[model samples]
Target: MDKIVLLPDLAKQDNFYQENYLLFLRRKLRAAKIPCQLYLINENTSDNESFVAINNLTDTYYLFDQILGINTLSNPLFLADLKIPTDLIPNFQDSRTDSVTFWQGEQRVLTVKLNKFGWVRQVVSYQSDCFIQDNYDVRGFKITTEYFDKYTSQVLKKEWFNNYGELIMTQQNSSIVIAANQRKRFRQATYNSELEIVKEFLLQHVDDKTLFIADTDPDTINLRLTLPEQFRFCFLITDSATVPVGQNIGRFHNIKYAFRTVSLRDDFLQIAPEVKQEDCQLITPVIEKANLSLSNKLVAKIIYWHTGEILPALIKDYLNQLLTIMSEQKDVELVIDATEVLQAVILQQLNLLIKDAGEKTKPAPINTPAVVNRVSCQTLAFQEEKKLMRQARIYLDTGTKSNFTLQLEALQAGIPQFARQSNGLITPEVNGDLVADNGALPEQLSLFLRSLDKWNNSVIENTRIIEQMKPSQVVEQWRELL
Candidate 1:
């Protein structure tokens, strides 16, 4: 059956709720190892605007513009009032099990923490007997049959026992911090396709670990409140991602992992392709098929950087710069000095940039204490590290600076991650992944590169951009001009 998705009651009233909800839904599902994606179906309509989410039951995809709505498409109320689609009728919603039946009694609002791991729902007004399915019926996006039968059995379902159903699993005790833009340069995005692909990709990659994200309120925040039970997490690191409405459903649902603290990995960043950060992973598949002129590799770097732990405003800007350069300059890498010292140089330059940011304003990275310990103490056998180095020898494509920096930093800093060298050498073991037996680490590493600019424009524009960007608009705006 196709799952239905909904904006949180508070988010329905607030336009700003989207971003936080996005991060919220992402972290919980990923942490629980549940196969899910936050589908943002932004529709360009004649009257106002709207974005709807549908769950993917299959491998099929759809464009957002094709969805139908009467009022300003952005309003969930307008959507709810509309007739249910005939095609969606067979989605298998059992009114008896799906909705809580209310007896003839005064309704009371209850704030129930649904998913034990960490999923929670904000106050919902209903009779005690009435069952309220968390936003599943409305905002959820479902892929067509092609999507379901194709990815279901193998990609998402196969891991059912390990990822989605684990009572508790061993975490690598290490972390991968990424930097990515909040937005992309592509004129149009195929909503369902991007979300599900990345969801599957992450499930196939990454080890057991909790995910903490920095975001805004409304859309992203309500996501926590709307998640169904069995979908919760150990912790949630949030900023804001909500959508406010005049009706004022309730306070934004906020939850922090009990013993978890946001740790500062670096005041800096990197990427994991589809394998690293969820932020870039979110847009990765969509960006891949788009006809944008940008080198898929370079944009991957931007996606990587955009997945970082710094200020998202910066990440957003850097992504724009990346796209601008990629669109105009047929070439992204202008050969500079090549040496093993390249990684060290890149790290030094990035540190210098963060130092400069301190001169102007007090900076704060996510304070994850446990994460700091893990980042400070990860290990690998000499043979394993050597094997990864050998694989690294095969996949590196460009930028001696970025490649060396990502891998060397992981090793030097004691992170489990690895990198590809400038020679197109892959060193997959250096990658810290168990999934990529075939592809190089570049695609994933590049995702980390753009983080500097994507998360904190002030720092990137003031420092890193001067070094990494080409001589063009790549140095410019979208709240990330660096």
Candidate 2:
């Protein structure tokens, strides 16, 4: 097995060279059906985990160099000792070395050197003549200096290079003209477009079982929410400034709906008041209150900013609504940044309110206890019922137990399982008596029961003559039920 380790040259000044070179190399390698495993080195990579894993699986290593600082080879033990004549060595004043060298035992097979500013200055190889001849079909492109010169000169100006020694520029076509700044802008736009396409492709094909680690960079943060919902979990390490509140709210919406668990950074709460207000408004309907938490520190900060005055009515209403939803959803976790001191202060305030209420209600003992208003209670109940109905529908859609399977079979048979009730009787009349018996159950549950009963009867009737039935007849009957 062979391994191809691709490390981007982050120091490259030209974005075109940095982005396209790897793409071109990878494509050519893949087209040739080379048995190579490619790995990308990112800023977050702290150890040699990828290298060690690849080396364990393969004997040969091919490092794809883009003339970046080749500091990736930190271990000198991996390098081969090859003595080159001093005359062959390129001379430099105040020399600072940066290069990737490949070795097999004591033989130095290849060496690619770059200067301090990350420009390719030299390439040295000591391999046999047969080595170049055997790989000429793949390596022949390196000898075509004119091809690269022609292509690069069109997009890049010679003046862009820091030090031009022996470099020669091809004559620019005078007919078509482009300003320097315009060319730079065009290159940036093209780079961004290509990056987006690659990101989209990776998102579409990402394996569900693997872990995807993304940095808090603006580009990565923007791409995070586009991932598939089926991912088991997602952990994001982000800065408050990189992702705006509007974008955060949108991404949170996806996380709340798609992912089972999400760990948001503490800095996520550090947002502008206006942004916070907008976020609360947008997220209130979609997320349960139990899954939302307003940090007390954040609340106190806001209050302090407002000179300790009470919050605006809109914000107060949003908090109240959130509390109501949270009260109903006990399983969902909402960790607030409330300190022990704040909790104690809240408790003391509540005690004072209770004491005051008790003094006023002493004359009317019968009406002493607080009672919720009927309309508010009804509204809460309605919301709870709606949530339950939604859950029941989801369960019916995805459940796979025997009972659910039977219900699905009945549904396919054109039997209306989710029929409405009229005067305590199941309407559309298939197994009305059975449905009535299960009246204590929820509507969807009752429907499933009735549908299951119908399916059981069909199964029984079909099974009696199952042995006598032809294969086609059995399939037809099953298909009808399905």
Candidate 3:
């Protein structure tokens, strides 16, 4: 049987699967024994064309925005042919679980509760069309969809309520709507090589104090540089390889730029903020107090002790205290000592609290290589190794393995040795060049290190393992280069 699929409009400001309604539908389909593949649309392209192509592969394909009636395919069935069971249809009453209460300082402004089903109900009541406006308000509640769209904008529809618990008005043309509508024109500027067109576009529409680019496409980077000096631009660097060339060329434009590196595999986003000497001093006490003698894992546990107990405000206060200490003492050693002391103290406290909690915690798990047995090795060459290493440059028994060794040596010399993973098992079946310079190796290696760092940080942040250990554990773990 051909597979069933659900394709999301990646260009859609919000992820389609993130919607509770779609999630509900997915569960229902799975329960009905329907195999569904989720295709994430990444490129900025025609949605209808993409869906049609995807539909050609699957027996049945459901477009995420099918409910919006936006698909312009020649096949009408593609738009409204989902055979979802009637019983599986969302019941607003049952799904009404969200509650929101708005407050004006000490005074309660309004309160509302609703769900995706409830929003759908309101949409249906207003119009018979299945396509729901991005935002609509029902009763005293406002409903909105959150997603990063092609314009890299977040749009919302809000409903206002009076203090008397009555619906005041539903604002359809909100700021988000204006921003969303303007994105198309702004995007056009990216394609125009003329600097004046791009400059004019920024002058008219780039009003935000900070602009965040979800992906670092070349066009987006071009537009980013057009912004006046007053605005701050924060770009989400997905991969070092994808970083636009000449990023530093526009440095003279007086733009303030910040970067937040994201690792999709590890699910980590780290803000790369410019740190000052004073800021370093502020964090010194926390590090100094931390017990450096303990294993890195143990230290991590102590730092994250009681995990959720550390409130954002408390962390802020700790940072403020560090800053205060730095301002008081100009001595760099004092600042370093303070950081070490603070680190030790925080870890020690966590250790004590965790011990009292009566729960055993273990170190975070690391990736391990498969064991190589003599028998397994004999048959390794016979296995379907060809299918596994298609992208890898395979090297046959060419002269001395010394050439491959030299390539590895070159890779290590250029890239950090700690960044690459060592392949423990040597299989005679796989005869491919391990290192292939497809003109992207350097960029890929940089990305690998970044992703490795992100993965390590995530593990440390979430687990109690060698929490006490230094941040350099990631380097040590991947020390063996392949």
C-alpha lDDT score of every prediction, in listed order:
0.26, 0.28, 0.27
lDDT of 1 by residue, 205-312 (tens): 222342323232343344333443333222222212221221122222222221110111011111111211221111100001111112222332211220223233
After superposing all C-alphas onto the true structure, candidate 3 shows an RMSD in angstroms of 25.9
TM-scores across all candidates?
A: 0.18, 0.23, 0.23
The order by descending TM-score is 3, 2, 1
Write candidate 3's Cα lDDT for 1-482 as tens digits: 23333333333221212232222333444555545445332221222233223433443322212211123233222102323333332322323444333344444332233343322112111122222222222222212322222243333234322222233223343321213323443344122233334345334423544333223445545555565555543333322344343234234232222221112211211222222211111000001111111212221111000111233434334322322322332321111112333445544433443354444342211100110000011112211222211211111111111222222221211212111112211111121122222333223222322243532332233223223322243223212110
| lDDT of residue 456 for candidate 3 | 37
Please give the lDDT score at residue 87 for candidate 1.
35
Alpha carbon deviation, residue 250, candidate 3 (Å) = 5.2
Candidate 1, backbone clash total: 134
Candidate 3, run of 10 with poorest lDDT: 366-375
For candidate 2, the lDDT comes to 0.28
How far does residue 53 in candidate 3 sit from its true spot (Å)? 19
Candidate 1 TM-score versus the reference: 0.18
Residue 23 CA error for candidate 2 (Å)? 25
